[model samples]
Target: MPHSHYAPRQHASARADAPRQHQPARPDAPRQHTSARADAPRQHQPARPDAPRMSSTTSSIPFVSASMDLSQDPSSPYYVHPSDNPASALVSPVLNGENYNHWSIGMKRSLISKQKLALIDGSILMPPKTDPTYKAWERANNMVISWITRSVSPSIAQSIVWMDKTYEIWEELEERLSQGNLYRIAELHQCIFNFRQGELDISNYFTQLKILWDELDNFRPLPKCTCEAMPDTKKYFMEDRVIAFLRGLNDTYAGIRSQIMILEPLPSLRKVFSLVIQQERQTFGNETDMKVMAINGPWRGRGSSVNRGR
Candidate 1:
């Protein structure tokens, strides 16, 4: 109870209960934040593609863009490819006067592939000069004309000198050439009869015959019979062709022909052709072997004589 600065010291419990004074925060200490991230610099973010935009008018409508691809549209026949030009040779063999059948067929195929067959077949009629596609049709038609003119001999080209349209040229050619189907049939028959494999090989002979047969077929189209007899009719025709093919072969194939004919069911023309070809190969090989033996026989004889003397 002595006067110690005239003041008594408070207990430790009262000091602990007293409020503390304010202090500056340390750099590394966790501080109370006013906002979680309100003061931080904002980052630029790209809009999501699927997110709806906040527009009063457009918010209710979907954002869309569309484009049409028409480069490969098949229904558009007026489109001429960039590669199709005046100087392009479509067919291998150009049209000559006598080969109209072959030339016309080739031209038809080439035009059909190019989608320009309608121009020549009278399907795509000409349009008036005032029409929007008139110039387009004219350009395509002129291109076709150039191809046709260049695909024929000079003398033959003269025939189409006055023609202007594709159909005109095509019709003119067909008229001038297709009139002699009967005469052509007779000529083909004569040629087939005269054609023989005397000096020619089997393949060449068959190829020549096929050419004649195909040409004749164009003139004389096969019947499109769906009847029950159609099968028998085709078989009869096949047998006739086999006979014709065998008849053209050299006399060497006579035995093979006999063997083929003796069968109850005659083989197909191609089968008979293959069989004859095999026989031909065998005959050729045997001849080659015999020639080799003949050449070696004399040498062998000489060698034996020389050895005996020695």
Candidate 2:
């Protein structure tokens, strides 16, 4: 029995020896295989009864909320079509209703009209009164008058001399004619007439003759008649008396030709003649007949009748 002794055995604790238990499956919780209907819809929601409902068929229409949101949100990278831009749409309404373009055009036209009217009214017009051209015209007229005056003086003076010389020669012939010195008278008359004719040729006698007649109309008794005339009361039978007077003269004499040539100094003799003739006509009756008589040869002499009747 002493050899059969045994070691004492210890009992095990219940908490240390117990195993971990698993959680029980939840019945009301979501499962990994549940259908999508179990989650809320992100893309669509049911409209509240009081909220405005958009028509499903009216998809083309834009929502006012979207437009306002786009305008308010600068960060949104969105824009309306060019046709729908507010500024562009307002342009036609403003122009047509307010006539903005028309008003601008009318204003410009009014300004231009005012400028044109001012021009036509001569408000800013300037005259050429102080210009060189005006002065030149005045000077030219004065020069013409001076030239005319100078030219006429010489012609008139020369004509007077010729007339005086002619008268003296005629007086000498009359003295001899009255004394019954027929040969001497005839010779003297012929010589003097020829001399007068030559003087006429040199002086443009017909022209000077007209000037003389014109001077005679206003004749106050001068110291002498430059061209002599028989007393008006004395009648001569010689129809060609003036021509007879001219025929007797010759050109060789110095006084005859010198007086004729003196007319050359008068450039405006023709003009002076016209003026004188006009003045003479006004003062007296037209002396055209006398002028014609002077130009044409004196009246033709009557022929002697033959005694063949016996």
Best by lDDT: 1
Worst 10 residues of 2 by lDDT: 86-95
TM-score of each: 0.66, 0.13
Model 2 stretches astray by more than 4 angstroms? 1-195, 199-203, 220-310
Worst 10 residues of 1 by lDDT: 301-310
How far off is residue 284 in model 1, in Å? 1.5
What is the Å distance of residue 58 in model 1 from its true position? Answer: 24
lDDT against true structure, model 2: 0.33
lDDT tens readout by residue for model 1, 91-198: 768877677888888899988887889899999888899866676778788889989998988887888878889998999889987787788899998998787865
Q: How far in Å is the alpha carbon of 166 misplaced in model 2?
A: 40
* Model 2 per-residue lDDT tens digits across residues 47-131: 4422444454354355444335432242322222233322221112222212333322333343243222222222323226674
Superpose all Cα atoms of candidate 1 onto the true structure and report the RMSD in Å to 1 decimal. 13.2
- The C-alpha lDDT values of all candidates are 0.74, 0.33
